[model samples]
Target: MLKLENITKRYELKKKTVYAVNNVNMTFHKGEFVSILGLSGSGKTTLVSQLGGLDQPSEGRIIVNGVDTSSFKQQDWNNYRKNNIGFVFQDFHLIAHLTAKENIEIALSLSGLTPKEKSDRAEELLALMGITEQRDQLPKQLSGGQKQRVAIARALSNKPDIILADEPTGALDPDTSVQIMEILQALAENGHLVIMVTHNKYLARDYSTRIVALESGKIISNEEVRPSKQYKDDQLSTDKSSLQFFTAVKIAMNNLKIRKKSTIFSMVSLIPSMVLIFGIMNLIFNMSGYKADFKPLLGDVLGKDNLLYVTPFEDEQLESTQKTIYKEVNRLNVYNPRIEPFKNTIIEPYTDDAISDMEDIEGVDKVLRNTYFDVIIDEKPFLLMALPPKAYASYQYGVPKKHYPEDHEEGIIMSSEAAKVLLQDNHASVKHLVGTDITFNIYNYKSAAIKLPSIMEEKNVIHTKVIDIMDISTKTKLMSNYHAGYIYVSYGYAESLRERFDLDDFTLFSYSVPDPFKSVVGVEVEGGFLITGPQLVADPLRHLRIKTSLQEKYNLFQFREFDLNMRGNNYSVKHTVILNDAFNKDSLAKLKEYGHVTKSRFDAYSVESAKKTNEYINYSLLSATLIAVVVILIPTLLVCVILYVSIILRTKEIGILKSIGARNKDILNIFTMESGILALSSGIISLVVALPLIQYVRNILESEYDLQASLGSNPMDYNMLGIITAFILSVGIITMIGLLPGRKASKLQPNTLLKHE
Candidate 1:
């Protein structure tokens, strides 16, 4: 069943070629009990190793069942050892952790038997070896003879074609040695090709059917002592099977269970690395300000890139219209026409035709007009702004839901500062001022020169309720120069007021016509109508007093004199345009043709500034991540080196596993799984410990210093997906670190490893 043709195994030491087994030729058939006798360094064990496929011969070819093994691929050799041969050693190389029965079962795992069949087979082998009582005991708990018996059972478990025993009884007493020889003879009788290498000639002579003696590196003598016995029918063919993945994992798990302290220590060492990675991810998320609470502060007031503010520089038509209305109203015969034409003359209100023209502009989604006026609220001056319904609905943040005004509501939304002033108490909060009434005094400036009795009747005083309050502290541009505060009335309500107060009448005199030459009126002289030339010199002092008095009342009528140059045009000098798409260079240039354009939400500078800040933060975060990896690598490399040394220390165990049909990939996977488990355990523990601690620190800062130092306290708040990704990355790194040691252990030669042990 086996053939070795001129097989020679050589080794190189200091450039010297030493022949361990030189020019050897041997052949054996089934059912032959052969003993190879030689002194130390005489190549007895080397010959047996070459026969068992443990070490490849440097010269000559080994043939098994008519197939040459020298040309066999790696998998083929693994198969040859797993199915065709079994090995026993002087030290009885059974796994230290597994019980005797489990040790035998590991070999049976390579067979295609079911788990129950393997267990039953292991029990049968233990009974046959006369160690059934010791099947549950570990190798360390068994006697030296009992351990050898377990080793023999494990070797026979697979029902291999060849049994190679190198000094199987070398460490036993005389009685145990005799019993081990009888077991080998029994294997030979059962149709196995048993080849035993030993130094004792007495046992070889008594037990073997043939004896082969070696001197130096050649076979000096070969002869048969007695006739061979007939082979049994069950053991003629080789067992062809392989270790299953599940069985390999079971063995790996058992090995780890035996070394519990070492596994726990490895897991503990990974904690700091996990904490560092998780903490960095948390900081990056918080600094980006992408959390839920901060979304309101990002200013979605106009809805992304949809809104634009347009301001016009000049409009001649509006000026000409105002002048025509002034001249025509002066010819009318009326005490007070109630509504003045000049009041509606400012930037001629955009007509339907003009609005339609603007809507046709490329990229112009929608257009809305905004108007600001100075008004007296509770006797204090404040700026009042009118907004479209969309703009009103967009002001959700910092505005209470209970105070939100409907689209057609007549009530106004007051600024927090404006509410404080109207309530006459600086300490009043916005919530307490809701539903309060405030009187707004609106004056007509165009007809101020025309004075009459009951002039106060010309002034439009409306008592409006405060429906909502908005915090505008951070919006500096929106606040304007009104440090006293501001109020927001809907555009529809403000337009209704103009009609309700008869503000369009240019022929109406303010109760009485003013004597422009002598009367004192509160208005600014620079922009107001005055008699110049001879009229100024007629009463120079009186004119100067009149101008000063007019300047005082000038501000009261300031809202009317401002030219409404946008009249008869759909586009106002200052208007907001919502776009159909995000702003780009082409769209922005097109928008600039209509007016001075600015984004309603974010300015170009702010967006650019934010981008640069985020880039810097990302670069810094990458650097920190690299540093953290290096910090983790130092200990990880140390662990790998330590594991490498530990494998070197356990060389005997590795050899024993190889002898029992464990493949290189099997050994590699076992070690890698151990490392992966350790890394995953560490990551879970660190996340559990770090999240609550971070929350505690955040709470302390908030309570003690009124600081919003934390983005969130819950796991979901701090990027849970990122945490899981980090854990998987950590396990991969740890597995890579363990690969070197696992590879080293897998490549070790069983013959060389056993000699060291």
Candidate 2:
């Protein structure tokens, strides 16, 4: 039962009020076929909308089963429309994308029936409407009368208490109109209230047990032609159902199918972003050399961290205001122990006592002392490093397989580049250079600091046999100018030259240190100690005894000068101390009592510096990736805007769905799912298309850049996780963009939407 008490609906045009329905009072009972007949603009439709709860009257209360619905919320109104009333529009507003049976099933989806039950119910209703043969046919494929029958069946799907038909047969032929009216009359006979609004008097007169006439905004007449047959009311079913997730997905897929061109276009729009993201990730992985099997060439040169380099220095002072002041040095100066003139000329080389003291350090595995000097070979200056024959055996870069140099032998090893420079005319192969005699001229720095070029005094001339020519590319880090020329000779020959020149015995003692990256120990020199590991730039020595003892033993009170053949004007008394792999910070501090200590070329001390450099590189890469994402957003933003406009254009369809028992959340799910589907489809297709393109690009790079070994050599090189992450992120963002329009469409009233349609 439904009742209207003084219901009024008003509209304002140009500041003048016009009433669509005014002061209407009526009541209708179950099992009644009631017809409201009026000319156009007679408020019949507005009154029906008020009864159906699709629109609220401006002034009055609609009473259903003795409950006033005037103050009902929007959700309550929706529930009322869903469970209590069914609507039939003039144009048969069935979803264009669904078949006749599917359209009915959509309404049945709110019946709380299982999927199979809903299917069975839809078939039964379709058969009852005499359109069972057209169940699988779309709305456009059906005849106009068939479409109207399907619309009526869908209206009956929920088993509502009231059927509100707005011109149910307005577009049908006379015979079809008769058939439609008979259906309504049968529903009334079956204990359901059927109300129809029509402009045709003949149809109304034939179908009605009661007739109500309206003129302008007021009801002019109400009359009963015959007493309606009284029947026991068939109670409307109260079961409720919600939109399931899979059902939502199916509905979304159907919508996408109906709009094929738009969906394809959306998918195609995402390809470029996907390809660029994948390609960049691949490049980063390759450049970082992340393969498990790859090892750096530096590892071969460093030889497992068992060597250390030690350089000694002399302290300096200046008199200021009649007081002695010790001068500080720059910490960042990688080259330390500045060599100066005469104040401290002679370097007290590490004696047997000093060597014993160094070997006594905590982690001293073995100590090998060597002397290095600058010599002239064939009028070209080259660095000459002299070490014992045993030390030569430990050389990482090059050691002769045959004819190895002995301790007392006069054999020398020269870099291939240095030999080429020295023997310009007769520079043959390494085998030819072997057994060839080469002379080295050593300057007498112990003579005097001459003011002018009076006569450069030559201290000693030594002739030696060339035993080997080595390639020094792997030892580049050991040289100040990595590509500079150099030579290697035995310690006995160097000692003989030193004796003849009357020069200071500048011995270099080396040992090893442990955990090279974390060690902070160094021997105390003039101003500061030479750091053993590359981890630190320059840190002051912590032990005072080591500093004081080193200063006293090395006679390092003032800086000294030495004449280096190739090295222009810089001077210092340099000594080296080697450490085994067992040295710790304490061992390094103990060594500081002798002289400034540094790690040798073969140590792993530079690992820390390399790690820091990698960290900066990673940060730069992250910044680049962020910039790339922002660039990708340009197109993503465009897609979002387009999707919003597309949703806004479908407001009428949204209203139709709501009228058919779809809740706001259901409406929201439909649109958001559509966007997600678009994003996912695009992402998947783009990834599929990118794999071959990436391979092709890799091939091109390998051939063009000669990087075959570096580009695609590893099988575990794809960015699968990154690709999946991008897809999810893209779908989420697009779904969020659809929310504003989806919510707006869902909140719209059915009557307002139908009026526009």
> CA lDDT of each candidate?
0.63, 0.63
All candidates' TM-scores? 0.63, 0.58
Instruction: Look at candidate 2 and tell me the lDDT of residue 351.
Output: 64
lDDT (0-100) at residue 116 of candidate 1? 95
Candidate 2 similarity to native, TM-score: 0.58
Candidate 1, superposed: residue stretches over 4 Å from native:
230-250, 257-261, 282-593, 597-601, 616-620, 701-718
Report lDDT (Cα) of residue 633, candidate 1.
84
